[model samples]
Target: MRYSWLALICIAQLSFAQKKQITLEDIWVKNTFRPKVVPGFNAMSDGKVYTQIDKEGDRQVLRVYDLKTGKQERTVFDNGEHTLEGKQLSLDDYSFSKDEKKILIRNEGQPVYRRSALYRSYVYDMSTGKVLQIDTAKVLHATFSPDGSKVAFVSANNLYYKDLKTGETVAVTTDGVVNKVINGNCDWVYEEEFEFTRAFDWSPDSRYLAFYRFDESQVPQYILPMYTGLYPYNYVYKYPKAGEPNSVVQIKVYDVKDARTVTANVGTETDQYIPRIKWTKDASKLCIFRLNRLQNNLDLLLADATSGNSSVIYNEQNPYYIDIDDNLAFLPDNRSLVLHSERSGYNHLYRWDWKSKRLTALTGGNYDVEQIVGIDEKRNLVFYTAAEKTPVERKLYSVNFEGKNRRTLTPEEGTHGITPIEGFNYFLDRHSTLTMPSVYTLRDNKGKVVRTLEDNAALKGKMWEYDLGNISLRQLEVGDNKTLNAWVITPPNFNDQKKYPVLMFQYSGPGSQEVGDRFPVRDFFWHQMLAEKGYIIVCADGTGTGFRGQEFKKKTYLQLGKYESDDQIAVATYLGTLPYVDKSRIGIWGWSYGGFMSSTCLFKGNDVFKMAIAVAPVSNWRYYDNIYTERYMRTPQENEKGYDENAPEKMADRLKGKFLLVHGTADDNVHFQNAVMLTDALIKANKEFDGEYYPNRHHGITGGNARFHLYKKMTDFVLTNL
Candidate 1:
C-alpha cells in the first residue's frame, strides 16, 4: 500500500513536469496570449455614457455605451454610411467639439514623427448631418474652435483657419517653408521630448489663437537613407544634436476679430524652449511654460493677450534639471491654477492664486502624486493617483483643495488606472496585478464598483494551459545603500538545489518605472517562454527610476548612465550570492534606453555579466537629440566628461562578454548613425561582436514578420550564449 501511494505521488509530479510549456511561437508568431483592450473611450458631455471606436466590416463606427449598464446606447457615426468627396470616408480618429454639436474627423493619417501626423480633416455637424472638409490639403493638428464656428489646422507647415459658416479660409502664417519655418506644429525634438504635436491653443472665448512659430533654417539637418527605391533616397530634416543650435521659437497670439497677430513678450533667449501654452479660464490670460536651455529653471508666465505683455507667475528652479509634466490645470474660478511641483522633494499639487500671488499646498506627502484625475470645485475635492500605498502600485485618492480629507479610492492591491467622467461623478478603473490580466470596471466617484466592462477571461483561461512561471517581487539594497525594486520569475518546476542561468532586463531612463505590479501582456509571455527553457528572468528598477521621489530619480541627472549602470551592477552582485543563481552564466539585455543601459552594463560590469544584447542603443550622448540629451547631460560641450566617460562607444575596448548588437536602419529616434559609429569604434578596438540590422525598420522594428524574426533570433542568441 505504501509503494502504491509513493508511485501515485511520483506520477503526479511527472504530470506537473510535463504540463504544456510556453513557446516563442506562442508569444510572437501565434500571439496566443494577447489581451483584449478597451481602446479610445471618451466620456460624453452628458456625464452618463462614453463613446468608443468600433469596427464593422471594413468601416469604422463611433458607438456610445451607457457607463452604468455597459450596454450600447447608439452609434454616432458609421463610415459605411458616410461619404466624402464621392468616396467612402475612412475614419482614422474622431473628436467632438466642446459643446458636442460637431465632430472633427481625421482620415488617412500619415505619421511624420513620434507624435506628429498629417491627416485629412473633416467637420461633421450633428444638427444638419452635413460634412465639410476643412481643407483640400492634408493638415496636422486640426481641431474645431471652442465655439464650433471655425476649424483651425496646420497645412504645409503653416497655420490656417476656416470659418465654418462663411466657408472662408485665412492663412494665420505664410512663412512656412519646408525645413525652414513651422507654424502651428512642433518640430521633431519638441514633439518627441516635450510630448506635444499641436503647438497651438484656442482661447476660452474663441477670440484668440495662441501658436508657436519655429525658425529651423539655421539648425543643422540630419539625413536618413530610405531603401525603398533602386537608388536609396535620402530623407533630410532639421535635427539638432547635442551642443548644436536649435530652432528659434516665437509665441504669438492672433486676434480673430481684428485679424492681427501680436508677439508675446517672452524673453529674447533664442536657445530657450517654449514647451507649453494654454488659455486660462479668463480668456485675457494665457499660461505659458518657458524653460531655459539647461532646463534647470522653469517659468510659468501669464501673458495678456491684448497687450502682448507677460509676467512670471511662478518660478521653479532645480539644481540638476526641471522636468516637464502635464500638470497645469486652470480652475473654473479663473483666479487660481493647480500646478505640479516638487518643492517638497516630491511631486505634489499646489494651488497658485493670481490675486494673492501665493502658492498653497493642496496635497502633501512623501510620495509622488502620479497624476491629477479630476478637480471637483463644487465639492472642494481634487482626485488624483499617488504612490501613497506602494511605489509599484498607483491608488486613486481624493483630497480637499486645502489638503484635508484625504481618502483612498482603490482597495485592490495592484496598479489602478482611472479615467474620470466629466463631473468626477463616475470613473473607469482599469486594474491589474503582476499575475492577473487587466480588469476594466466602472466605479462611482466614491469608489463603488458599478460594473465590469472587460475581464479578459479568454486570455486568462489560455494562461492556465501553459506552465507559466511564478513571479516574486523583492527589494534589494544596492551599492548606494538604497533599496531597489526587482521582480524575478522562476520556472514552474523550479528546484531550490539547482542553479539556474539568469537574464536581467532594465530600462533605467530618468523618471521611468518598469518594475510595477501591472501585468505585462506580450512581454510576460516571452519571459514565461524563457522560464520554460530553464532560465530565470529578472527585471530591476534601479536608481533614476520614477515613483520614488525627486532625489532617487535625479541621482543620475548630469551623469546620464553612470549611477544607473552602477545600481544594476550592484543588484547583479547581490543576486550572484543567491544559492539558486548561476553567476557565471548571467546575462543582461535591453532596448533603446534599456539598450543603452545593457551596453553600458556589459562594458562596465564586465566582471559580472557573461552575455549582453543591446537593440537600438544610443552609442553616445552627442549623437542623441538636443532636448533629451541636453536635459540630462547638459550637452557634450558643457559636460564633456559626463558624455565621454559613460558612453559605450568610448568603452568598446572594455567589452569582455559575448555581445550582440541589433539595430533598425530606419530608427529615427536613435538614428542608425549611432550603430554605425559604435561599430566603427568596435572595429577600431578590434573587438569581436555579433551584429544585425533590419533594413528600413523603425525603432520598434515591427511590421509583418519582423518582430517574430527578431525575437526568434534573440531567443536563439540567449539559449546559445547565456
Candidate 2:
C-alpha cells in the first residue's frame, strides 16, 4: 500500500508539471492567446445572402454566401482570376452599389489617420465583368452613386467624380490646396473629434453631391520630425490646439448634371462647427448638424440642395457639451428622423417629426442606451443595445416607434454585440462573458438562435493547458454611498491567508468603462501572465465612466482628472484594507487618458501607490485638440484653473513613487510635446523618474517588435519597482 501511494503522488506531480506557462512572446509576438474572430461580411441587399472576403489558396476572393445555410452561393470577384493593368489585384475592402450591379473595390490602402485611409480603387461591373480604375493614384473615400452611374472620389484634397457610362471625369473643386483648402474631406480636428473621414455624401437620386470644404490656412500647424537620414525632415500639419483658430468650414452642394456648386447657408460664424452633413430621404433636402464654439448647443438644419437655403429643424441644448454620434437616421417618411439624446438624464432614442416639430421618446430608462443598432421600418421597431441589467453588460433590445411592445432580443447575462442584417430578419450576435471567449451566433429577429458560428472552442481548449487565475467582479464602496465597478484577478493557487502585491489598471476617461463583463483579448492574457507570477491584478471603472447615467458620466465635467483620480485613490484605499493585499507594494498603470489618471493618482494619492507606469499620457489638456479639450475643460483662456489644476505636469513635484513614463515620438493625437513638457517639469521639480521614447512610433507604440519590447520593459519595471 505504501508503494502504490508513492506512485500515485509521482503521477500527480507529473500531471501538474505538464501545464504550460504563458510568456510575453506568446501574448504579443506569437499571438498564441488570440481568439478566433468572425470574418467581416456585408449583408447583401437581397437579405438572403451576404458577401465576405475569403482566401482561396494564394488568391483573395469575394464570395457571396447564403445567410441561412452559411454556404458559398456565388463568386462576385476573384483577384486571382482578374488582373488590373496585367498585374494581379489584391482585395483590401469593397462595397456594393445601391442596385448591387457594380462594386467599388479598394486595394492597397494606406492609412492616413485613425479613421481615414487612401486606397487604390477600382470599379467592377457585374454585367460586363470588367474593372475600371477610378484613379491611377491612391484616392480617398471612393464611393458609388445611388444610381450606379457615376463614382466620386477625393485626390490631393480635391473632389472629383467619374461618369461610368461616358468614362469622363469632372473636378468639382479646383482650389483644393494641401494644408490650405481640403475639398470633400474633414479637417484634422473634425475628423478626430467628430469621428468621421468621408466628408461627402451622395443624394438618394444621385443628383446632388454634398461635400465639406475646409480652409485650414488660418489653423496653427504642428511639426513632427522624422529622424531617418543624416538631416531629419519635419512633417508639418494643421493641428488646432485649445484656444487656437480652427478651419473655416463651408458646406457646398454640387449639381452632378449641371456641374454647378452652391454654398449652403450655415450662418456667418466661421468659429462654429458643422460636425455632420447627411442627406435626408428627400434628395432635395440635406441635414446638417451645426454647433457653436462651446459645443453646448446643437442645431439640426435642413438645407435645400438647389437654392442653398436652410432652416433649423431641431435644436437641443445641454448644460454640459453634447456628444455627436452617427445615431441620427432619417426615416423613410421623409419628415421623421430618429436620434439619440441625453435630455432625459440618460442616453436614449427619440423620434422627431420635423414636419410638426414634435418629439417622442422611443426608449427611456435609468440605464443608458449604448447605441441605436438599426431601425426596422417595415416592422416599425428600433433595435438598440443598452445597459439595463448592469452598467458592465450590454444587451440588445427592440421597441416600436411609439415606444410600445418593448422586448429584449439578447437575454443573455454577458455582452451581446448585435449586428443586424439588412432586412432585420436576422442578426449576428457576438456574445461573450468575462470568463468565456466570444461565441458568434446567427439569430433570428425573435432572438431564436439559428446557428452557432465561431465559438473559440480552440481557445477554450488551449486555456485549460495554462494556469490562468480566477477573475471576479466586485463593487467597491468609496465614500458618500458611491460604489465603483471593479474586476479583480487573483493569482493562481491564491491563498486568503497570504498577502499579495496588487497592480491596479484603469482607463478613467469620460464615458469610458474599463471594468466590464466582456471577454478581453490582449490585456486580459497579459494580466493572467502577471497573475501567474503572483501579482494580483485589479481594474476599476470609477466616476466619469459611462453607462451609469448622465450625472455619473458627466460628474467630472469642467474638472477632467480631479474626481476621477479621487475615485481611484478611494478604490485603492479600500483595496488596502483587504487582508489579502499588501498595502506597501501597490502599483498602478494606464494608457492615454488612463495614463493621465495613473500619473495623477501617483502624485495626488502619493501614500497609496508605491509605483506607476503611464504610457502616451496627456500631461496637460491645453496642448490637446480644441474640440475635445474645450468640450470638457473649455478653452485655457476661459477656464485656466480647470486646465491646469489636475495637469500631471503641474503636480510633478508631488511624485513620491517609482514612476515610468513611456511615449511615442510621432503620436499625432497626443503629441510628443506633452512628454517633453512633463519631463522638463519633472526635472525642474528635481523628481527622479524612468522614461522611454519610441522613435517615429504613433500613439499605439506598435509596429515590428515595438509592442513586444514595450511590454517587456513595462514588465521589468513592474517586477523591479513594485
Candidate 3:
C-alpha cells in the first residue's frame, strides 16, 4: 500500500515539473499566447440577420446568418463562383449598399498611413451575377451613392463619380494637385490627429455631395529619405508644425442635378478649422463643425445646399479645449439632435431642439459615458455604455430620452462592449475580465443571453501550460489627494522575503487610458513574459488620462507633461516603500506618447527611475503637429514657456542612469527629426546612451521581422539595464 501511494505521488510531481515558463520567443516569434476572436459583422437592415466573411476551403465567401437562431442563412458571395478580370475573385473586404442590392468588393489595398488606404474596388450586382470594376487606378474611400445608382471615390486627391446606369465617370473637381491642393480628402495632419480619412459626405436625398477643399501651398514641407537601392529617394509632403501655417480650408457643396458647386460661408476667418462636415436629415441642410485655432470655442453651423449660407445653431466654450466625438445622433423627427457634452463635468448625452436652440441633459452622473450604442427613436430609449461601476470597467445601460427610467443592462463585472441591432431588439455583448478572455454572446435588449457565439475555450485551456502571475487592479494615491488607476503583475511563486526589480509602463496621453478591465492583450502577454523573468510589471493610468472626469483629465492643460511626470515620480516613490520592491532597480519604458513620458521621467525624475527605454518619442512639443499640440499647449508662440519647460530635449543634461532611445527613420507622425535633435542634445551634454533606428519603418516599426526584432532588443535591454 505504501509503494502504491508513493507511485501516485511521483506521477503528480512529474506532471507539475513539466509546466513551461513564458519566453520572449513565445510572445514575439512563436505567437503562442494569441487569442481567438470573432470577425467583423454587419447587422442587416432587417434587424434579424447579419453578414460576415468566412473562409471556404481555398476561397473567401460572404455568409449571412440569422440573429435569432445563430444559424447560417445563405452564402451571399462565393469567390470560387465569381470571376473578376478573367481571374477568380478573392475579396479582402466588402460593404453592402443601402438597398442591399450591390456589394463593393475590395482587394489588393495599399496603405497610405495608419487610417488611409487605396484599394482596387469592384461593384458586384446581387440581382444579376455581374461584376464591374469602377476604375483601372486604385481609389480611396470608395462608396455607393445613397440610391445605389452611382459610386463616388477619391483618386489622386480629386473626387470622381461613376454612374452605374450609364457606365460613365465624371470628375467633380479638377483643381486637385499633390501638396498644393487636396479635394475630397483630409491632409496628413488632419488625418493623423482628427482620426478620419474620408472627407466627403453624401446627402440623404442623393442630389447633393458635400466635400472639403484644402489649399496647402503655403504649408511647409517635410521630406523623408528612403534607401531602397544605391540611390536615395526623397518623399516630400506638406506638414504643419506647431505655430506653423495650416491649410486654407473651404467647405463646398456640389449639386448632382445642376453640376454646380457653391463655397460655404462658414465664417470670416479663413484660418479656422473645419473638423467635421455631415449631412443633416433634410437634404437641403448641411451640418458643419467649426473650431478656432485655440480649440476653446466650438460652433455648429447649418448651411443651405443651394444658397451656401450658414447660421450657428449651437455654440459651446470650454475653459481649456473641446473634444469631438461620434455622438451627434439625429432623430427621425429631424427636429431634435443628441449631442455628447462635457458640460456636466463628465461626458453625457444632451438633447438639443434645433428650432428652439435649447439643450436638455439626458444622462447625468458622476461617471462618464463611453459610447452611444444605439438609439431607438420609436421606443424613446437611448442605450449607452458608461464607466459607472469603476473607471477601469465599462457597463451597458439604457435610459429614456428624457432622462427617466434609467436601467443598467449589464449586471456582471468586467468590460462589456455592446453592439445593438437596427431595431434595438437584440445585441451582441462581448465581456472580458483580467483573469478571463473574451466571451461573445447574443443578448436581447433587456440583457438576457440567448446564445453563446464564442467562448474561447481553446485559448483558456492552452493558457494552463504557462504560469500566469497574479494581476491586481488597484489605486495609488498621488498629489492633490487624487488616486490613479493601476494594474500590477507579480511574479509567479513570489517569495515575501525577497526583493524584486520593477518595470513600469504607461501611455500618459490626453484622453487615453491603459489600465482597463479587459483581457490580456499583446502588452499584457509581454508583461507576463517579464514577470516570469522575476520582474514585476506595473501599468498605471496617471492624471490626464480619460474615463474619469473632465477636471481630472484636463488638469495638465497648458503644461503638457508637467503633472503627468510628477505623478509617475510619485508612483515610483510610493512603490519604493513596499517590502518586496528593489528601490534602486526600478525602470520605466513606453512607446509614442508614453515614450515621451519615459524620456521625461528619466531626465527630470532621474533619482526615481534607474533606467528608461523610449521608442518613437516626441522630444519637444514644437516638433509635433498643430492640431494636437495647439489644442493642449496652445501654439509655441502663445505658450513658449510651457512648451520649453517640460520638453525632454531641454533637460537632457539631467540624466543620471541608463537610457535607450529607439525610433523609426520613416515615421511621419512623430518625425525622426525628434530623435536626431535629442541625440544632438545628448552629445552636447556629454551623455552616454544607447540608440537603435529601423530603416524605412513607419511609426509602428512593424514589417516582416522588424517588430519581433525590436521587442527582443527591448527585452534584452530591460534584462541588462534593470
Candidate 4:
C-alpha cells in the first residue's frame, strides 16, 4: 500500500516535472533496463531449495522450502543476525556438501583476479548446530570432500585439508610455488576460461585426492598497478597477456591415508588444461577432461590412481572449440556418461558407454539443450530444458533413451528453471520474462501441476506506478554476413520521425545470451531517463554470441572481435534505416566481455558508431586468463593475428567517437589492466576517452556508493555522448 502511495506521489511529481504534456501511449519501451539476474542458486543435496527473498521492510532472508510442497520450510540463512550469535552474517556466496551436512560459507571476501578471495569461511555443521572457521587465516578455495569428513582448502597458492573430527589441519602440498609454482589449483588462465577455481577432487571412498599443479616460472608475467582511494586499497597481481606463455599444468593424486603423492600424466604434453577431474565409482580410476591449448580437441582420459596409467575413454573435437560447461554428467553408476555436444550443429545430448566405449546420440534436433535437469536411470529417461519452444524462451521437458516420449512440464513459460527433487519424481520451478517477474511452481514427472509456489505479479503491479516513458522492443538484423539477431529498447514517449539518438548494449560472451526474453535491469531505468530525454537503445547477438547453434555462434572463433564488432556496426547502420535513429549519434556499452565488444566496436566500427563505453574489458588476450582466451583464439603463440589485429589497444588510433571507460581497480576477471592498457594505448595514439576508476570494487562493481554512482556516471555518459 505504501508502494502504491509512493506511485501516486510519483505520478503527481511527474505532472509538475514534465517539460510538456505526454500520454502513456506516447511512451516508448526498450530493452534499456537490466534487471538483476537470479543471483546464483543453491540446492541442498537433500532435495530442499533455498532462495534469497526480500521482505516488506528490506529484510533479506534465505528461505528454505520443500521443493515438492512449495511450502516455506525454514530460514536457513539471513542477513542481520536474529540468532544467538548476535554478530551480523552476510554471504558473498555459499556451497552445500554432498551429504548436506556442512555449508562452506563465503564471507568478507576480497577480489583476487576475475573472481573474489576465499577469505574467511565458516563451515557450519547442520546436524550439530556448530559453526567452525576453516582456519585462523582467511583461506581461499575452501571445499568439502564427498564424505564430508574433512574439508580441503587452498591458502596462498598452497593446499590444505582439515579433519572435521579432530579439527587438525595438514598442508597437502608444501611445494606451493607462486608466480612460478601453484599447487591444488589453476593459474589465472585456467580460472578465467575453464571456469574452475579449486584444482582438487575427492574419491568416492574419500581416502585419496586428485589435484593440479602449475609451474608458471617460464610463463611471462604482465604487470598492473594498484591504487589507494576512499576504501584505500593497494595490491599487485601477476597476469599473462595474449602471446604470453601460460603455466605448464599437471595433474597429481595424493593418498591421504599413506601421505603418498603420485603425478598422473596422460602420457602427453598437450595437457594444457585439466577442466574437470572426478573419481570413478571404483575410486581407482579418475576421469579427467583435458583439452589442447587450441581448445579444439577434448579428451576424456581415465587415469589409474595406483599406477597413473592413462587412457582416453572419450574424445570430441570442433573447429571453433568445445565449451567447458557442466555439459558432461557422469551418472551415479559411472559406467555411463551423458554428454552434450554441438557437433551436429546443435547442442544435443548423447549417452556414452564408458566400458564399451560406444556413443549413442540421445537427443537430436535443431534446438539446443539448455540444461540436463533430471534423469531416471531405472526408466532411462533424460529430463532437460530446451530452446525448442522459442529461441528466447525455455521449457522443461523429458526424453527417453530412444528419444521417445518427449514431454514438456510447464505451461506458463518465460525463462524457466527446475530443481528436480526426490530423484526426479518432483521439481520446483522459478520462471519469468521481460514483461513479468518470476513465479515459482511445483510439478510432478507427468507434467502435471502439483502445487502453486509463488507468483511475482505483485512486483509488476508495484512497478506500474512509475512514469516510465514509452518502451518498445524491436528486432535488428545486422552482422558482417548480414546474419545477426538483435533487440532494441526505446525510451518511453518516442516518435519514429524524430530521429532519436541510439545507445547500444551487449554482453557478447562466447556462450552467453544477453538479449533473451528476460527481466530488464537498471539499464532500463537509464533508458527510461534517456527516453524521457529522446534516445533509442539497442543490443544484438553478433557472431560468437551464444545458443544460436555452432556455425552462427562460432564465426568469431579466431578473431574474437572481428564479427562481433562488425555486427554492432551493422546494427547501428540498420538503425539508420529506422528513420527514428540518428546513425551518427549511436553509442555502445557493455561490462567485462561486453566491455570488450563495446571497445572493439568503437575502434573497428568508427565509421558507424559515434561513441562507446567499456567496463572491465580485456584489451588483449595475453593479459587475460589462459583457459578462456586460449579456448577462442588458442594461444597468442598459435594465433597472433587473431589476438593482435583486433585488440582495443592495438586499434586505439582509429577512435573517432566519444569513449568512456570504467573498471574496478580490483577487478579480478578481466583485470583492471585491460582498461589501463587501453588508456595507455589511447594516450600513445593521442586519443581521448572519459574514464572512471572505482577503488576496491570487484568485478561486479559492488561497494558503498559504488553501484549507484556507477549507474549515475553511465547515465551521464550516455546522455552526453548520444
In model 2, residue pairs whose N, Cα or C atoms come closer than 3 Å (at least 3 residues apart or on different chains), thus clashing, are none
TM-score for each model: 0.96, 0.98, 0.98, 0.85
Two-way TM-score contest, 1 vs 3, winner: 3
Task: State how far residue 22 of model 2 sits from its true place (Å).
Answer: 1.1
TM match of model 2 to true structure: 0.98
Error of 4 at 690 (Å): 3.1
Off by over 4 Å in 4: 1-65, 68-107, 122-133, 229-234, 469-473, 479-483, 620-622, 671-673, 680-688, 695-699
The regions of model 3 sitting more than 4 angstroms off are: 1-13
Writing each residue's lDDT as its tens digit, candidate 3 over 1-722 gives 99999999999888767778887678778888777776868888888999988987888889999987879999889888888867877777788899999999888889998898999999999899899999999999888899999899999989988898888998999999999999999999889888888989889988888999999999999999997999989999999999999999999999999999999889889778998988887889999999999998999999999989999888989999998877787777777888888998999988899787678888888989999998898899989999997888989898887888899888889899888888898888899998899998888888898888899899888888878788988899867787889999999888878999999999899999898888873388888889989999898898899999999899999999999999998898888889999999999999999999999999998988999999999999999999999999999988999999999999999999999999999999999999999999999999999999999999999988898889888999999999
lDDT (tens digit, per residue) of candidate 1 on 440-543: 99888889998988999999888877788898788887775689998889987799899999999898899998898888732777888899899999899988
lDDT of 2 by residue, 189-263 (tens): 898999999999999999999999999999999999987899989988999999999999999999998989999
Each model's lDDT? 0.89, 0.92, 0.90, 0.75
Each prediction's number of clashing residue pairs: 1, 0, 0, 45
lDDT of 3: 0.90
